[model samples]
Target chain A: MPHDHHDHLSPSGHPYRPDQDGPLTYWQAMEIAIRELMVEKGIVTAAQVREQIDAMDARSPAQGAAFVARFWTDPAFRDLALRDGSNACAEMGFEVGPMRLIALENTSRLHNVVVCTLCSCYPRNLLGLPPDWYKSRAYRSRTVREPRKVLAEFGTILPEGVELRVHDSTADMRYIVVPRRPDGTDGWQPDRLAKLVTRDSMIGVAEALPATEAPA
Target chain B: MADFAPGARVRVKAMMPPGHVRTPGYLRGRVGEVERVLGPFPNPEQLAYRRKGDPLDLYRVRFPLGDLWDRDDADTLEAEIYAHWLEPA
Candidate 1:
């Protein structure tokens, strides 16, 4: 998608600085010229970049939802998923690169929220790209200092006595919150149960919807 | 660093090395219990710079929210930090 940089970039080709009085700055023009030269020389192809982007765009929270649904219905699968999330995700045919994937279980006594204080590192294969808010300065700073308040902002009001556990995704380790299965989901199949799990729920900002609210 | 198991008291070293570090600045110098050892992994700090290096042990440490900040109402904070940045509490 050849997006219009008009809104984000100044005429000078800088993001905000418009000191130059040209449509494209010298560096910007040089970049385009070099890119065209490379493509003309068959050094790199534009198709390759688009293909990578399309692959990324194809991933969504549905993958994580499927894993959670399986975990909810099968105790053995739950053990496997909890023990090694990377392996579980791999079994489902998702490529989670090399990082230790840990599934944090949210029970009646605890709630888990994942964040990367330094950068927005996430399980992109399972959960798609990190949301804008997840990468914001406000979230990165406030989550550790005041988790309850942050959760409240996300409309996730925890019950009294439940300790909110914030997991800082600071290293080569990723986290996914396997929220406590909602009540009244008895005998629910994985497909039916998957509908109740949302992206935010897997991130620990919300809970799985009640079965009644689930889609038919 | 290898034998640091769950329930072990560990403190995040206050030292701040230059260049890319995955450990958050806030948790530095804080004491916490090792919730779980997350297994040995390549040193991300080195890997990030494209340097091949040996793996380092990583652990999931849990710190009390009250201890990290003045807010008594905050809940616990857990983070996965590399073993090199930790010490016996």
Candidate 2:
């Protein structure tokens, strides 16, 4: 009676996601039939299919945090990361796969912004998933040529003195911004430093640590 | 060069299936003439392993910027090309 969203689970066991494609409502017999048919035809093995789905669910955000950690304590490594993004990702136990990725470092003087100018070429291997706003058409079109305007739209006001360079990441590669370390974290270990690299900071939508509060 | 040459229409395809398709929804079901064709290039979606196939032929098909947005409201009449994925349309 209270505008129930999960009405499908009321009578049946299956949880119904309100937002699903197609005209059909929840509990589509067609989906089950198609899967069963595929299984019967041996188009894909059950275990193989299960494992693939499991792999998607198994993804963790720690992969990105680990990447942030390595860049904090090591300057030489940071240099390499800015030079070759894929190598740095590998050093942090992540892979960009066959598609190449680029790493951008946002400093006090320079702001490196990333956008899938064409589409959403996110670094899901490391970042897990892209945030909703990253996928918006507003972000894709405006970020490339009018970066300052777009960043401002995201509530990030780049200082007039600071130069904003937008990186247009396509499908083949990704660009990650190595955020700067906070000021108070003197003599901090890499693990501790990594904690400061918030996802927003890495995206250049927000500045890195050294603000009034450390990143959550 | 003229904005578009004759007999040079191209059918562009979507690079990604879901989430944020690079192809704007407005461009879908629309056809335009091929303004210019670049060399064969690798498909970004396929390279990401999100989609599969070989490199595709990309074209810089011109659509008036105003046409993409709103004809009356768009600031400049400057022409912009959307990345044209090869197709029969």
Candidate 3:
């Protein structure tokens, strides 16, 4: 009786249905069919698909943090990033693919925030997968209409004198916000400065952590 | 060749065609200035249909928040719009 009772439960003691175990949806079926067809036709091997997936998964906000940290400490590198973001990333050994990259600098007088009103087009190469909220219908529709309100909800309160610039990633170009360097970190090393660069800061939802708040 | 140079005043065409488009609906018919020329790129409208889309010049158009909405601040919104979607303002 005990064994019979446990038979229906998953290892975690809940009756869970994994995606593959459940009935396949239309899109899932299409994907599987196309993948199989491509593999059968020798267009791409299964290993290649998995390798690409792993490559994408390997990218993370840390890459962006490193780039931003370098930008804060090195003037020459900052100029390169401002001139050509894609090339600058490439120089740092990060592959940005074919999509154009633009660095939006946040200054004392200006603030920049990015959103894709149409779809969730992001700089996946540099920042890894986007957070679910970025792709939500609420974010897509509301960011353009009331950006200051949206930013305020994220705890990013801009001063009245600062101008907020919202970039809608509608087409080919991808943007990365170069958050202003925190005060009192003038002589900080790149490695130490990188710890202050959070994913939201690079995305422009927040600012870099102040020197006093730097993690131990 | 590029039709609009940087700082040119351009307006998004007001037409709403039923197909894949990169231009956002809210920007249609709105006026903005060309912040910069992003050079030629393949048209997504044609590429979405699996056709060989000829390249079109792309521009970073900057719109004042007041012009797009009922805001009184100096905030702005910028979007990458293809050449076909813009007309001289």
Best by lDDT: 3
What tens-digit string does per-residue lDDT give for candidate 3 at B1-52? 6899889999999999998999998999999999999868988999999999
> What TM-score would every model get versus the actual structure?
0.86, 0.60, 0.90
- Each model's lDDT: 0.87, 0.61, 0.91
TM-score of 1: 0.86
> Residue-wise lDDT of candidate 2 within A120-183, one digit each (tens)?
8777777767887899988877765466677777778877777665555533456677666667
Q: What is the model-wide C-alpha lDDT for candidate 1?
A: 0.87
Off by over 4 Å in 3: A1-23, A41-43
Choose 1 or 2, whichever is better by DockQ.
1
Residue B88's lDDT in candidate 3:
99
Error of 1 at A215 (Å): 2.5
For residue A76, give model 2's deviation from the true position in Å: 2.7
Q: How much is A15 displaced in model 3, in angstroms? A: 18
Kindly give the stretch of ten consecutive residues in candidate 1 chain A with the minimal lDDT sum: A1-10
What is the per-residue lDDT of model 1 for residues A72-95, given as tens digits with 9 covering 90 to 100? 998888898888888888887877
Off by over 4 Å in 2: A1-38, A46-50, A210-212, B1-89
